[model samples]
Target chain A: MTEQIAWIAVDWGTSNLRAWGIGPAGAVVATAGSDQGMGKLAPQEFPAALMAVANQLALPDEPVDVVICGMAGARQGWLEAPYLEAPTDLIALGQGAVHPNMPDERLRVSILPGVCQREGGENVMRGEETQLLGLAVTAPTYAGLVCMPGTHSKWARLEGTRIAGFSTAMTGELFELLKTHSVLRHSLAGDVNGPERDGGFLAGAQDGLDEPEKLLGQLFEVRASALLSGRTPDWCAGYLSGLLIGTEIAANRNQIGTDPVPLIGSATLCALYARVLAMTGAAGRVVDSTEVVLAGLKAARASIA
Target chain B: MTEQIAWIAVDWGTSNLRAWGIGPAGAVVATAGSDQGMGKLAPQEFPAALMAVANQLALPDEPVDVVICGMAGARQGWLEAPYLEAPTDLIALGQGAVHPNMPDERLRVSILPGVCQREGGENVMRGEETQLLGLAVTAPTYAGLVCMPGTHSKWARLEGTRIAGFSTAMTGELFELLKTHSVLRHSLAGDVNGPERDGGFLAGAQDGLDEPEKLLGQLFEVRASALLSGRTPDWCAGYLSGLLIGTEIAANRNQIGTDPVPLIGSATLCALYARVLAMTGAAGRVVDSTEVVLAGLKAARASIA
Candidate 1:
């Protein structure tokens, strides 16, 4: 039996590609993901990759629209979907979507533009704008702080349906670099993350929040703590994570207003952020990231339609 | 005519081995260096590597006293010279020197133990301890603050001839990691350090000094600023150096005390630091690292004699 498909939603980032097959009522009927992300794909290779996923999930014999977000719209991705200047309404992201020419008659694709900040300090975001759109759709009149934690974590200020300002912290990247490439690697034994309530993690986070400026000095303590006191690798990992996240939250704590900040990311990562937020006397709630992405894509489709 | 090498002072770090042949009066008569750093050598390979350097710089037929510092004394280096816990007397570093076995009768070597802080936040130092010893010898009554900038930058508080407390910052290593491995690499083009008065560098340092916690965010701005404003690679390099050093200084500013902090490093790096210190309302004086190392080794030689 051929399944009826409304459209395809894709989030192509630097290291991974995720595709979702949506039904008529915004239900995800099938999902596919692979390592063939924007970093690995060339402009010409995008269609074949998309086709492979589309063919695997057999659908009705008719033309279907495909809306993509994330790095797929980056300058080096499939095609440049120029960024939509911030202070622009989040729900209206579709207006800035750019359609790329496709050889396949059965596929019609629209790549959504990211958000770019030109003033104050220059900043840019790709797929996160779609997540913001999802938040705007779920709560049309919502306006406050939203934290998206990942490789390049973003803290955004949303006002009603528009994004007022945002800042990106290279927390995840720094962690990876320090763990894999820096001297701190010698001190760590295995996995660095565990439960949110770990004492070491809390202690490290508290220290970071208390003295965010002391980050450079605090990092060396991880190795010393491990060497001098025989600290376990897991504890070291927790401490390092706590320190990074704690510093990030402390740096941006002023942005949190009356509304409880909503965290949009993976469950594990969001839990970490939520815990750190709670420790810092701020309220944070984790929302389902996949659901938000799907909803965001659906909203974008409606605007274009 | 062979030079009269009374002793040898060696600073063997992770990446390079530098050996200075000292005359009777503590002046460097000959110098030799190689890539035989601790990272690349095993215990069995140390003798051959040292012999190669000693043979190149001809001296007396009899064994000469040698004082080794830095990672050469690490557990994984030539042999373990366990850290001397602080508050250790700088003048007594030689008393803790460990002698590694050598088959060659032409060399008598003593490796200096580094300083470590076991409580209140664990910290450790290796080569910098020797430099501190040199500072003690050069300025007997000097007691206040000292900043040694490098891969693992150290900031120490000195009281009389003892090291009261010290902290290490991963400023240099972090800068290298981000510039070579992170996304910011694309924005950078050439060398990382430039002139002192470079406007971009100064501004970045000022920003970092003002808000050290915002480092993670400010790093991203470098990329965005480059893409949006076409910032040159030299400017980016200076800005990055400024940011890291600035953050480090701001974090450790309380340790500066009443006297001008003395910077113990290479001339170029010390100049950069001196500029930053002046910017932060603190005076910094540059001291020759080699001279300090020779002075330190000579002092250690006296104690062991």
Candidate 2:
């Protein structure tokens, strides 16, 4: 059964490493992950970290192709996979993949290069590019705006299989920073992502959409609302999240255009973005990040094959 | 000369304590300060911290009236002064002052209450209210919008000597957080507050003012611009500062009205703000925060007297 495995697919990011064992027929045989992210590993540690998971599947002695994407290719990661400038063809991403030397003869890893925008304002994305490639593979002719939300949310405008231009928003990072490290932290002491879907979240999103420039002031109102309005901790958390997300959406509203913005990410995060996008009168279609990442890696593998 | 000290004006905030010795003739005599701020002091440590500075100005063993403002009056400070609800008469702030028991017989400290707005949304300000009082004392008939720029930048609408309504923007804090904690820290390394007045600051501010909702995305550009445009560290610092401040100003543009907004803060900081405010088509009159605080404390003293 293990002999059926043909290649491997990995999404190696800053904080975590996820891998899926793909069969010869393109079916996923097994999947695994660890906290051994690129940020945690030095050049020497990359092979062992990958082998730690590779050995679990009792991979045969034959060489196996492993398609990797994300921070693993950063300058500080296992090997530097230089950024491919934007307006890049998704099909060409495979050409940008750099092969990192591995101790195990059985594992041949190709790390995909992240994309960089050198003009306008400098911008870069590592893993999301793979996700976009995956999205491209899923719908070969799909074109419009694509948003992939996470710690560093990426918004891209795609023309067929080529990414025309893209922008990254610090919404997720800002939300986390405000939730855990700010004065509003006192008011949001409880579950920062509580089950309670308080109206404060929608209200905050609406406020951000209505007046995105006033965002910093609106954020202060979270603490103020807690102090004066006696808003619950859950509501405060929801409001802050809403405001950050709403502002991000409003900031990129023009990019969304008339097309249904395709949101690629985990269900929880995508749901939030989708809901907010709908609130802004834009349609959103959610796609699981795993599906897109796998499809993206598979596409890269096929291209290399 | 020491005995000429009629009273002590103290601005005890979260991180530091600043005091001014006032003569009976209403002139500032000598001044001193200590690192022991509200955040650093326990209830028992407050008096000693105050004494550390108070003792420097040697005097007879007689009680000296110390009018204190800022976080020293917070629930967690020397003594809780409670909030004076907004639409509050600046003159009444002194009436709401609370006295904390002191072991040093020579110090009779009166801590002023903060101002809180309960309507619309909950908002609170401790030290800024005193500055408003001081501004009022300087210009008794003054009326219009006042901007006190700091960690929690405040904007207040005043009707004569009363605070009609007010709002706080976490501009300074956000700047600090992004500079020190966020990924932008890489580009903003070295002097967080550099002497360089790169045109980048004004440019960033103008961009923020022009399109505030695009702030989160624009912030990413700081990093992008650095990576691609090779922007210097000083330029990055100024640009970030401008973007945050400009966005804050853009958000609250509706409140600026036609009058010259009074900016109360240190000369260096207020100058940056004044410049930004001017860029936004409004005139900004810089008022030294020290002068305003002292005048505010003096006004409170007279009201109590």
Candidate 3:
């Protein structure tokens, strides 16, 4: 049964490593993940980490072609896979993949290159490029705005198979920093649930969309609201989340059109972005991130083959 | 010489405390400070902390009035000195001062109340209100916008002696959090100085003032600039500082008039604000925080007398 293992697909990022074992028909047979992300590994240690994850699948005697994407190919990662400058052809992403020198004979590893926009204020994306590639492969004729929400949320303008341009927002990172480290942490002490959370989120999103410029001034209101109006910690947390997400959407509002934007990310995050998008009289639909990354990996594998 | 001590003025904040002993003519005769801030002490323990700082002055046998401001007057501090709702009369700020019962007979402590805005938006200021009062006392007829930059930078609109309205921006706190804890920390590793620092700061300030609404999208550019262009850590730090400050100023730009804005706080911080304000085609003058606070305490003392 293990002999049916055709090749491997991996999405190795800064904080986590996810690998999928695909069969001959381009379907996932086995899947594995670990906390051994690029941030925690030295260049030499990457081989062992990859092997450990692959060993769980019980590979055959023959070597397996492993198509890897993300920070694993960063300058500080296993081997530097230099970025492909935008506007890059998503289908041709595999043309820039770099083969890292792996000691294990069974692992034929090719790390995909990220996309960099050097001309327009210097922006780069590693794993998201593959996901964008996956989006391109999944919907061959798709074109418009695609939103991928995460620690560094990216919004890309896709024209056919080409990524014309894109921008990254530190919304998720800022929200986490404010929640865990800032003075607002004292006010946002509890977890929120139910209608209270929903109402707070919508109210905050409205404020953010209405006056994104006044975000700095309004942030202190979280503390002030807690102190003076007795707003609960749950409300504060929901409001902060909505405010950041809303502001992120508002910043990119000009690019958004009448068509439903395809949000490719984790279900939870995409749902939040979708809700915020709806408030702007725009629509969004969540596309499974794992599915697209796998499709993207498969496309890269086919290109290399 | 110690016998000439008339009263004491103290600014007890979240992380630090400072006390000044006044002589017969209302001049600073002695000064002392400690890390025993209101945040560190229990309500009962506040008396001991105050005594420790006052003991440095070798107080006379007679009872001494201790005038306090800042977080020491908050509901969570030594005693809950209720906030005086805005539009508050700056000269009459002392009318809301609360006295916590002291164990030592010689300590006659009066904690000044903070000002709160409940109508337009939830906003509050503690120690800065006293600085506003000090500004009022020093320039009795002067009326304009006063900026106090700190952990929570404040902007107050002064209509003669009355505070018409004000707003708070979490600019300083955001800068610290992003520099120390966010992903930007990796790119901003070293201290910057001289022309490069100034240049980076001005460039970032200009961008921030020009398009404050796009701040969320622009934050990631810091990291991108470092990765693509090999920008120095000094440049990154200076740029981040300027960007946040500039955005803060831009948010409050409508309130700023042709008059030179008065910046009150630590010299270094106020200087940064002044530079950013200048970038907006407005002038700023740094006011000595200590002198103004002393004058504000003196004004409060006069009110009590």
Tell me chain A's TM-score in each of the predictions: 0.95, 0.96, 0.97
Weakest 10 consecutive residues, lDDT, candidate 2 chain B?
A: B190-199
Return model 2's CA RMSD, one decimal. 2.4
> Evaluated with lDDT, which candidate comes out highest?
3
Model 3 chain A: weakest 10-residue lDDT segment is: A190-199
What lDDT would each prediction earn against the true structure?
Answer: 0.86, 0.86, 0.88
Which lDDT tens digits does candidate 1 get at residues A51-85?
87777666567899999999989888999998888
Candidate that scores best on TM-score: 3
In angstroms, how far off is A274's CA in candidate 2? 2.2
Docking class of 3: high
> Who wins the DockQ comparison?
1
Provide the lDDT at B300 for model 1: 75
Clashing pairs in model 1, backbone N/Cα/C closer than 3 A:
none
- Which window of ten consecutive residues has the lowest lDDT sum in model 1 chain B? B188-197
TM-score of each: 0.95, 0.93, 0.97
